[model samples]
Target: MVVAVIADIVGSRRLRDRAAAQRMFDETIARVQREHPLADQPLQPTVGDEQQGVYSTLDDALAGVLLLQLALPEGIEFRYGLGIGEIRAIESAHRELTDGPGWWAAREAIETVHARQERAVPTARSWIVAAPGQDEGMESRVSTSNAYLLARDAIVVRMTERERRLAYGRIGGLSQSALAEQEGITQPAVSKALRSSGAAALLDGLALMTGERS
Candidate 1:
């Protein structure tokens, strides 16, 4: 199967330090490269806040994305897009290939997440499949994609509730003690959650849901 992957930092601007951000990016790249099969995958830098690469199978592509997500520094998360299709080599000698339906599908998957991210919908993820002729492998990919979406939504929902509490605190101008008492949580927990980058990811997810620019 033809698979492509895209991964990026969640809230880079708030990082405040370009050097540190670059280090994170570099480390993230190294971590991804260490993953099997994708160790040699060609990584192409994309404009703005993302990077892309291609894989020959869904297993490798998905594993690579998940690894990047887990390896990211605190407050960072990843969204991935995978497409399966035919890859036709233009010139075997040069090893160049032209875009096909698989490529289009992968781009669509990333665009789907990009559009969602603009709405500030935190922790959103999606998968798209493109096999004109259904086969057992294609069927399996579809099933796995559905499962991934469901689990991703569950995580996003939980994060949303936490962010709502934090937003309420900020909006109401509540002191740490007051907010803690109101939420029945410790003052330190309240401060920690609000200050964490995960909350920023929630805002990014919100941007995705609301159609705001990321």
Candidate 2:
């Protein structure tokens, strides 16, 4: 079993330079993969405006997508769906194909997030669903993870570009002084942004999820 993900550009039609936006998206995904190394298959474009990836665990999926959210540049955004289940490949004469419960769950998740975005929660960017055969323990995890995703997306949507960069840096193990140098601000200012922007709490939550804390 694995955690599968589906993602797409949030406002594809409105992008001023579609090519550049895609390039940046690809680069950011590469950087996240390099820094985090959580994905079983690193996120990559699968078709027009869409991407896919695989993770070995739900925690990895959660952390990977969060890193992606912060690594992406201003004016570019993507929504993600994560699924936990089995996946299988279909043999094609010309090309490989993918199918199975994991992808189906991921599809459901993405559609759910899209619906949520159109409804009351416009900032919703990620959602999770589990395959029908998930055990009781897995189902409980799915419930808990969904709650985390909602709060994480809400905090991320409110962050300024600088705040996001700093948060991303912190998660990648950068010091506040280093982030301040990159942002051309004082180290104290970086600390203030990390606190005022809700990033510190988010990092703590991620740590707990990843077993970095008890």
Candidate 3:
């Protein structure tokens, strides 16, 4: 099975410089993909305010989305939804269209999260849903993942921009000293930012998602 992801830019219409914001968003996604090549198909704009991508696994989608969240500059963000299932393409004379349960689930998941954010949990930016017809373990997996995402989004929303930059660098395997130099701050300051902003916890969570730990 593959993981399909759909993302929508948040508040793009309200931005004064939509073109510049789009360029920045594209550049950041490119840089993150270079550092962590987890996507089967890199995210590409599909329509207004939306993008689509595929990953070989759910963990890749989760980690990839997190990288994107932390990498984005201040005042720009994307809400992400991931679905796991088989994907089939319908090729027409003009272009190929994706149609399958996976895409459907992704649509459903995105709608669910959008409604959720509007009502509450405004920081919640990512969610995953598995297409039905899986094994008995699907329910547990989905629930556990959603719970983790809720906490993850909350922590990320509370982080400062500098804290996010540090987190992104650390994910790319940069040392705290290295990040300090890049940010023009001392090592202790970088350490304090990571710890205080909950970036250290987010890093640990990402590591766990990627199976970097047993």
Candidate 4:
């Protein structure tokens, strides 16, 4: 089965300048493609402020989504929907269009996140829906996967700009001391910020996403 991630800007219409936001959104997607480069179908802006991509595994898709989320500029946030299943069709060649249960599930998942956001729910930015009958334990696995995403997104949404940079760097495999050098802060100060800002917990969650932890 393939994994798909569909994401859209949180408040595109409300933004003062749609053109600038679209430019930033496109740039963020390009950066993610360069840095992550794990998607089987590279992430690209499909329409307006929304983008979609396909990955070989759930871990890669989750990693890509988090990286893109962090790569976004200040005052810009996006919600994600992840799905895992077979692709049934490609509606367009040049546009890399696709039609499948996987895409449908992803669309449903993103809509769910949007509804949650509209209701002011906490940790409402990401959701996953594995295609039915893909496996006997699909339901249980989806629950566990979404539980992790909920906890991960909770920490992510609350991080300040500095904290986010630290978390992103750490997830990219940088040590605290290395990040300190890069951020021009003392090692101890970097450690303190990471601890206080939930970066440590977030990294652990990322490890879970990457299957580096039990």
Candidate 5:
């Protein structure tokens, strides 16, 4: 099964400078493309502030989403929709266009998130929807995936900017001492920040997302 990821900037219309936000959005997509080699294709801007991409596996797609979220500037946030199914690609001279059940399902998921946001649902940033009849166990898989994203995004949304920076550094394989040096803090202080900010829990959650742990 192929996983499709579609995301757009949250509250993008409210930004005082729309051009700067668009530039940052483009830069974030470029960074994700450069950093995430597992993506089926580099994420491309679709319409307005939205971008789309495909991944060979759900785990890789989720990882790429997390990377993109963490790479953005402090004031920027994104909502993600992940769908698992078959994708049909239409190749053109300029770019490869994609359609099919996968894209449709992803659109549905993103729209679901948007609706939740409109209703003021807390921590409703990421969602997953499995394509209909994709598998006999699709229901179970969708439930588990959405549960994971809900808990993951809930924790991430509560993180302070410094906490997010530490989490990003830790995920990139930086040691506590290395992170301390980068942050100009003591190693003990870094440890305190990680613990207090729930970075360890976030790491564990990411491991579960990647199927590296139960």
Candidate 6:
């Protein structure tokens, strides 16, 4: 069986002070536990800013990732590194994977995100999967640049943003109102346009134009 490791931050330090950050972390931990009660997994606190988790399947890991991403409290975001490998159970709920190329690939994935984050890519929300010595597609749900771009389009449609001067802003342009006015339409029409396949196609095109895939 394949094991997946996930690591990510729990809250917003830049936007919150020590007290608020602690509260956010506690709340995030509680939320993750509540969401994965049946996983028999512990969401381990990492360093002072992040959390770590392990799962036995791609579905579990991916579900947990999507949940954490969507359920994250305001001002909080996450980055993830998922690696698949062999494991020896330490207990019914815990185990340790043999680490090597598999582990390194996972680290590289995270490092790639880190580098992109440093360059301010898509607000640094990223995920990676690795299964060394096996088929590459066995690890990542998004196995190609096209797949990744499609996922990005989905995210663009899913999230409502107010921040400007970001890639997302550039993708759809200033705001719904601005786009509406520029197109000589109502705000609701602009929203409808954003919800249409046209917006998705536009995002895909922008992704290609901007070289968003990695």
Best model per TM-score: 2
Q: Kindly list the per-residue Cα lDDT of model 4 for residues 30-90, writing each as its tens digit.
A: 7767766877886667877788888888878878788877677778888999888878666
- Candidate 3 to native Cα RMSD, angstroms: 1.5
lDDT of 2 by residue, 103-125 (tens): 99999999999999999999899
RMSD of each: 11.3, 1.4, 1.5, 2.1, 2.0, 9.0
Q: How do the predictions measure up, each by TM-score?
A: 0.56, 0.96, 0.95, 0.90, 0.91, 0.56
**Pick by lDDT: 1 or 3, better one:** 3
Candidate 5 contains a number of clashing pairs equal to 0
The best candidate in terms of lDDT:
2
Model 1 scores worst on lDDT over the 10 consecutive residues at 205-214
**Candidate 6 to native Cα RMSD, angstroms:** 9.0
Across 13-47, the per-residue lDDT of candidate 6 in tens digits comes to 56547657556656865675574542335456656
lDDT against true structure, model 4: 0.81
Q: Write model 5 residue lDDT over 52-170, tens digit each, in one string.
A: 88888887877777777767778888898888888887988997677888888899999998887678676788888888886667777678878777777777788877788788788
Q: Which ten residues in a row have the lowest lDDT in candidate 2?
A: 205-214
List runs of model 1 lying over 4 Å from the truth.
Answer: 35-42, 88-98, 116-121, 131-140, 152-214
lDDT agreement with native, every candidate? 0.58, 0.91, 0.87, 0.81, 0.81, 0.51
Worst 10 residues of 6 by lDDT: 161-170
For candidate 3, the clash count comes to: 0
Segments of candidate 4 deviating more than 4 angstroms = 91-94
The candidate, 1 or 3, that scores higher on TM-score is 3
Backbone atom clashes (below 3 Å) for every candidate: 18, 0, 0, 0, 0, 0
Task: Please give the distance, in angstroms, between residue 9's alpha carbon in candidate 4 and its true position after superposition.
Answer: 0.7
Displacement of residue 162 (Cα, Å) in model 4 is: 1.0
Q: Rank by TM-score, highest first.
A: 2, 3, 5, 4, 1, 6
CA lDDT for candidate 2: 0.91
